[model samples]
Target: MKRKQPLLLVIIAFFVLSNFIYNVPNIEAATKLDIKAKAAIIIDAKTGKVLYEDNADELLGVASMSKMLTEYLVLEAIHEGRISWDQKVTINEFVHKLSSPYLGLSNVGLTQGEAYTVKELYQAMAIHSANAATVALAEVIAGTEGNFVKLMNEKAAELELGDFHFVNSTGLNNSDMLDNHPEGTDINDENKMSARATAKLAYHLLNDFPEVLDTAKISRLKFRDGRTYNNFNWMLPELTFEYEGVDGLKTGSTNFAGYCFTATAVKSNQRFITVIMNTKSQIERFNETAKLLDYAFANFGEDTLFEKGFVPESKKTLPVTKGKDDSVKIATKDPLSLIIKNGEKDKYKAKLVLNKKKLNEDGQLTAPVKEGDVVGYLTYEYDGDDLGFITDKESTVKVDVVATESVEKANWFVLMMRGIGNFFASLWNGITTTVGGWF
Candidate 1:
């Protein structure tokens, strides 16, 4: 009896230990990553796939992050030849007063009656988050900060950045502007944007003006007067919150914004953008961003689900009405590459959409089919919680599908025979229906 009792106790202990070990990882996997912020989002930089989001669409103050749009406009003007980097800009008395160190705002002191080149002010604005430098650049571009705000709003609309409003170029709380707030805006107005919209702005900024990183990545910049300023983004190398592959982007903080950051990083050739808004503190923003980024890099990798020229089994051939061949083989014009979560590959499926303009009334190609002709689009579907693209609510990421080989027009006699056969088939169907009705 004693030996049997010991055997029974051993069995029970073994079962309990095995179950505890098995459930530990399952519990951690279920929780995944959690970001502590008012709003947050992480997305693939190239494909705009939303990996994770929490209250990303809730509008919140953006603080100096508004300068990203201003930065965009400045780059656009330079590219369009409307402005030059070497062009000298005189600091107005208003900006000079606003830039005084006495105010304790982030700035590079600007002296009145001294002209600074556009590039100098840009470096100050980009590297130091200098408010006065931002306003100076705005004035150079639009003759006044108020007019520049108009351009900012217009560009925001054009970019389709929903849930955004630009009240000023500097993104300063109108109250902080010391009674010099831009015209047509209330004194309390501050730039506001949802995390999603901010991500979109960063997307466009990187795609349209990739060189912004050249400046954004600079950790320290020296003004002509010899005052050096360090970048506020501590994620940069040698900074306090350094993270591998961390690069150019923007950071904002205010009484209302509560430490917002738009951060981008690349690892193993895969790039991701993360936005954290309204974190508890400056360090908390970077800590939360690190958590989000680690989640992305550790759990996701670049995958080629379908290679170029690959054809879907269900949609391998498109019918041709008058071509020598009755059908044409179609394949993807480009590879379908995505940064997807590991082990979730089976949940995705390709969706092919044929071009309606290329099809005839019978839903077949009309005549000669040329090689490499665009016949449709190849998109994908994931049976998971898809937060959708950051740029738009309903837009789907897709690639072009095209014909793999040419199908020349059929001979005149062959076309005539096919037409005759189709006509007879239609007539026979009609005659059978009429006879049935009589019965």
Candidate 2:
């Protein structure tokens, strides 16, 4: 009885400890960061992998951040030869009135009947967030701001920027446009895009037209090496709230939009794009952005799970029917590299998925396969909590898998002989099976 009492107490204590240990949440699992903004997101600039998000899908006014779309179109036109940097754009009466300093809008004072080079207006728009400069460039490209609005929406759709509506090129409220608003939009309508869409726009802009950064990073804009203005992005070097590696992005604000910013930074060879919409103040936006950038740079890093030409042991070879060679080796078409959370590098599993449509009934590929023919994909499954990509809800990161070498079709005689040999082998096996069953 005495011994039983001690054992019973021990069991009770163990049960209590076990329950406490399991029921208590993991500290790591509780690491959901709270960002004080209406919408915010952080993504890997290279891979579009979303690192963190808070109400990122909510539609809200992007303010001057809307000019990023305009910037993309302008850069695209230049690249396609439709426009040139040296090409001059003439300012009109509407843009002149809109750009007037007395109207309480951000502008560099464009004069009506005066012409500025595409490069000059782009500098004003990109560096100062000048509303009139943006509109002038729009007019030069599309003949009217309303027509430019259509081109903006069309290009937005082409870029797959989901949940976006552009009513103007400069991102100002139509009422602010002083009744010279686009033809199709209501007088009060404003340019709106979700934080995810905004980040994607920045991604495409930086990726497609990298030269925009060359201008965006310029803290002081010099026109004719004389007139100058401060860049709107305060996070740039030597500016207020300046953060290391922050350069070449846009900032936005309006009475309705509060303060918004799309910022990109590079540190330790890793680049991250962050967006915060509707923060309480201009400074608060950069502060919140700093937290996101800190989290990204501190917690995430680029990792290569597999090198190019890596073949999964389980699916290293694929059978090729009617080919000079009976089989072909398969491998990853490129290195499987992506941004990954720190300390979770080994938690990813690789899988080889073959294309079913290209295979015959026996699961064999037809001959005449070319080298580097994409037959399938090499996908990775992460074992940890995945925030998912901003571009889509695809849970796995994937790369193409292709044939390591080409396989020529077998000659007719060689194929016929092979078919005959298979038939005889099958017949012999069936006959032996029946004779064995009789015994």
Candidate 3:
């Protein structure tokens, strides 16, 4: 009795410890980061999951961040075989005038009557944010800057950037284009977009044309005239800030737009895109971006909820009626991953939900089901406030549960044969049991 009492106490203690561990909630405390900008947003580049946002939907002048879209269109045109890098573009009087230093615009000093290749103009536009080079490239692609601006708007619409509008290929304000307004448009015209939409654009641009980063990473390049053009992005190493993982993105500032930056950084296979619009100063844009990046990398990480074609171990097989097999295996069509806060992996739970209405009276699927047929969905959810995730929103990941193999319906003859086999097996088992009992 004394020995049994000690064992009983140990069992009680184990139950108490287990209950405490299970009942204690993991909390993701909300973190507050002060960012000084009119609009700012941070997103996971791969997942497109927004990590932080402030006035992100508020529309504002984007300034030269518009160049991201311009560069994207140029790359698209190149990939489409519309133009090649070595193709020389003539320096027309219009472009020459815009490239002049007297206009107080960033230019690459293109000489009138002289021709430069598509590669030179692209380098100038991307590295120097040269307005003239941008227009030259636009003219080459769409025949006219106005037409290219139309294409830009079309692409913006296609990208679902509802709040974006572009009046010119260059993001120059109308007032700055007083002498250059050959089209006679308003001086107030400038490209406008929300920080959120601009981040989305940048995300697509990087994912679609990763080569843009190669050009954007260049700190300095020489024009055909041997004149040097320097990149304005300060986030690169040996630049103003020297952020470790910072890479190819754009910066913009105008009297109307103030200062704006779309920055991307990668570390540990995780990439983050940060956009800051209308900051007080150029330095502040980089500073605020650094702060945002620090917060995201420190607090957030990703977790895989399910691998492609993965089914929960317990639910490997599901009931199937009127079929040759009594059960069928199932799996998900795609891998399920989510951007979760650090130390919150254990809080996530996944459930397999079947389409019960499709089941027969016995709660088993009918036959003639093909492989990859959708049976239901596997939903992943988190129940705690530790991650600060929106509880009212839908599940984090929902993958389609599919049949692993086709199950043919059982024929009448097959069913009769199976019944006969079961009857004979039962009779043999009964005879053996009776003989053993007699012995």
Candidate 4:
């Protein structure tokens, strides 16, 4: 009994340490980050997960953060072979007009007919947030700013960059453009993308054009002469967090938007992309985003929370009926994981727990299906209060359930008739053959 008591005590101690005494490391939370931004958001870049936000859905002028969308379309154009970075873009009168020093735009310094590579324009637009270069690239890619705006809206809709009904690539307050008039007046209540979409946009740009960082990382770049400019963001190595992993993102500010930042940081094998819109000052944006990142690193981590496959224990397996195989197994298309506070794994337990009504027996999609389709959702939940709805409860990721290999072209009406016909024919043939054999 004495020996047993000692063993029980050890077991209890192990559970206590794993579950309680040794909790998830507490990283410094947002410290003295008191600033009144109209909007803000922090996100997990890799998973396209939103971790934090303050009025993230409120639409407001995003300011230079608009550059991220411009960069996204430019890269897409490059990827689709519509344009190349090496291709030279022409500098026109219109392009020259947007390059006002008062506007705080960097210049490409192009003489009429003097050509610069699309690559250089990309750098200018991305690194310097140069208005002239942005217009120049837009002209080259879509042949006009109007056309580029069309493409931008189309792409924005496609990406679901929330609540925007305006023209103009620069999110600068355009008070007079009648095309989509009445821009949301309340900066705190301004039109904006959700933190998830904004973060995803930032995530795409940086991950796609890692080279953009080489230029963005440089705090100053000279243009047109010895004209040197400094980065608008104050969250670099100089601050308290001194986030070494931080690099290459845009910052925004306007009386309405206040001070906003879409920041990307990399630590170990993980990356976090954050957005803070309508902040009080550049320092506030920096420090707030840093705290968000610190919290993410301390709690959540990137690991396969749930993988796509047979549910194993669930009654997930179903009959294929007319398909090639017996039945399809329902599971995740890709694994869902989190960068969550430690022992918060239970929060995920309810997440990976899926609903059957949302799935089909095919384990993929039910019907009216196309290959490479989206079938269900990966729901996540976070019960932690300090982290809020960021890392703990996540945006529902889509689940692509697969259909069986058998392609049944007929709809339900035809399938029913066909099934009946086949059954009757098989029965008739069996009866006739059996009778003949007996005779």
| Better TM-score candidate (2, 3) | 2
- Per-model TM values vs. the true structure: 0.92, 0.87, 0.79, 0.64
Q: Residue by residue across 1-439, what tens digits does model 1's lDDT show? A: 8879989999999999999888777644553567889998999988787888889899999998889999999999999999999999988899999999998789998999899999999988988999999999999999888999999999999999998988899878999887999999999989999999999999889989999999999988888767878899999998999999989699999998899999999988888999999998989999999998998898888888888888987789999978888898899999987778898889889888899999987889976888989998888889987677776633346779999999999899998998999999999999999999999
Q: After aligning candidate 2 to the native by TM-score, how far in Å is the CA of 408 from where it should be?
A: 7.1
Tens digit per residue, CA lDDT, model 3, 1-439: 9879999999999999999999876543346567898998888877677778888888899999999999999999999999999999999997888888998898889899998999999999998899999999999999887788888989988877767978887788866764564253566778899998898899889888999999988877788777876788888878878888987799999988999999888889888899999998989988998998898899888888788889776588789877899889999988778887778777878788888887887878998778988988887767764322212234545788899999999999988888899999999999999999999
Ranking by TM-score: 1, 2, 3, 4
Cand. 4 TM to true fold = 0.64
Model 3 alpha-carbon miss at residue 129, Å: 0.6
Q: State which candidate, 1 or 4, has the greater lDDT.
A: 1
Q: Which stretches of candidate 4 lie over 4 Å from their true place?
A: 1-35, 102-110, 175-197, 206-215, 236-242, 304-311, 315-336, 350-439
**What RMSD, rounded to one decimal, does every model reach?**
2.6, 4.7, 10.6, 10.6
Model 4 scores worst on lDDT over the 10 consecutive residues at 176-185
Give the runs in model 1 whose Cα sits over 4 Å from its true position: 5-7, 14-32, 393-396, 419-439
TM-score of candidate 3 on Cα atoms, chains taken together:
0.79
lDDT of 4 by residue, 113-132 (tens): 66788887777776667767
